[model samples]
Target: MIKIFRITAKNKILILGSNGQLGSHLSNDLAKLGEVTSLDRNGFNFENPESLDLIIKRLSPKFIINAAAFTNVDGAEDFEKIAYQVNALTVKKLAILAHENNAVLIHFSTDYVFDGLKEEPYLENDIARPISVYGNSKLEGENYINEICSKYLILRTSGVISKNEDNFISKIINLSNDRDELNIVSDQQSSLNFSGFISQAVLEILTELESNIDKEKRWGIYHLSGQEPGTWYEFAKFTQEISKKINPDSNFSKIDINPIPSTQFIQKAKRPKYSFLSSVKLKEDFGIELPNWKKSIIEVMENNE
Candidate 1:
């Protein structure tokens, strides 16, 4: 039987990109464990990599959670250099700093790292064949973290949504409020991740690490995301359905959701057609499972309202 670990106030946690959807949730959830020094883009600029090194050295946090990234998928196609700098170069610097400080680095990655050609859910050791600049940059960041930091947890999640940020669900909600109908892609397939659930899982993993378990076995890349796989059309439809259920009289309740192919929804970035991540490794190691995407959507929608 695996023993659950408890967190103490002595564990100093530093959260980068604290203002983001996932970062915001992490800051709130992780605060219960210890002193959390949350930093948004303004607080710590990735433009200046040196600033990261300086801050990590000064704070000397026991746990450094990097939730920040250049997440503009289509924008990255035009600005690859900026994306690489923010996502890959800065991450490499953070890993180095974390290693020097003897801190456990917790970094967030994406399912986009995969080419999405595989029909089955991707495992942790799957070969990454990123098709877009954003995906490439994220893959590079993962590589740097794995090489530089001996004690690190790289969580590769998919389609992260939350009430606080402009994610897929929020976009659908906003669009439904204005438009009568929507064209959602039906080709793309992946699990939707809730930032709140991801944050909670991270905390639980931290607790396990804080315990006497062999840190080496636990420290590595793990696929953490929703259990159910779905297409963008289904995700949007469910969002609309749940929104209507939550607010029957709301304008969003009447909007029509139409399913379309990926070719019709042309974008600058080429997203993977199928990039679902399997959380079996995480469950086997930590004995934790993420909540269902449908349940998470309802909770987020209700909470935001």
Candidate 2:
């Protein structure tokens, strides 16, 4: 069993983007460490950036966990205003608030920050050259946290999945409902990280720090992602493989996943062909190594079934 950590005094932890895939899981897991005050789209909507000042001041949380952002890759091409508002402008406010309150700001970024041109997995020090609007906006948010806040942790991950949200796993399941065959992009390569894993890693980091605000080399951006790199085509086929193993009567066997190049599917935004991140630094600092993407697929399929 995973050894859960709980602080003695119950530090107040404010979670932004509580309605998101990662935010939903963080809400429950962070509760084990402290009092989690979750604010989703309905309450702490990033679309309304000006309102965050009052809320952060009122709460004065010891830790601010930002699990929210504008994640629509294609839509960001058309609606850049709201994308920058939510991903960049709002993040700036949260960083400032965390700085003023002397609280630790834990912000989530994307692997999309890198152009995916590198031959190897992305390192924390890699020069970020985003290929799309969404990626650029997310990188801007990371910059805000780095520039304004001293006590901060910026975690950059990719291909995040959750049993709760409409993620890649859920999409495959939903598409399998009616379609007998699916054409998934195979040219793109990246890591698939589960929300549960991401949440646990964050909790462990907090536990290690014990909400310490003192300056340390560990307080910086880290690439936290899956154990291995794979394409969407592989991820879908693996999901089918797991579904059949767990439940022989499942409909996953009936669906055929065909691998295709990115050109086959036209989209408004450009995605990096290789945007996966390296978890070496995360392991070096925190001694946390996430399981393979296949294991996460099995657990996700088990829950969905």
Candidate 1 — number of clashing residue pairs?
0
lDDT of 2 at 129: 99
Q: Whole-model lDDT for model 2 versus the true structure?
A: 0.86
Candidate 2 error regions (>4 Å)? 1-8
Candidate 2 lDDT, 179-232, residue by residue in tens:
878899999999788888889999999888774546455899998887799999
For 90-167, candidate 1 gives per-residue lDDT tens digits of 999999999998999999999999999998999999899999999999999999999998999999998888886578
Among all windows of 10 consecutive residues in model 2, the one with the lowest summed lDDT is 1-10
lDDT agreement of model 1 with the native: 0.87
What lDDT score belongs to each candidate, Candidate 1 first? 0.87, 0.86
Best by lDDT: 1
- The residue-level lDDT of candidate 2 at 298 comes to 73
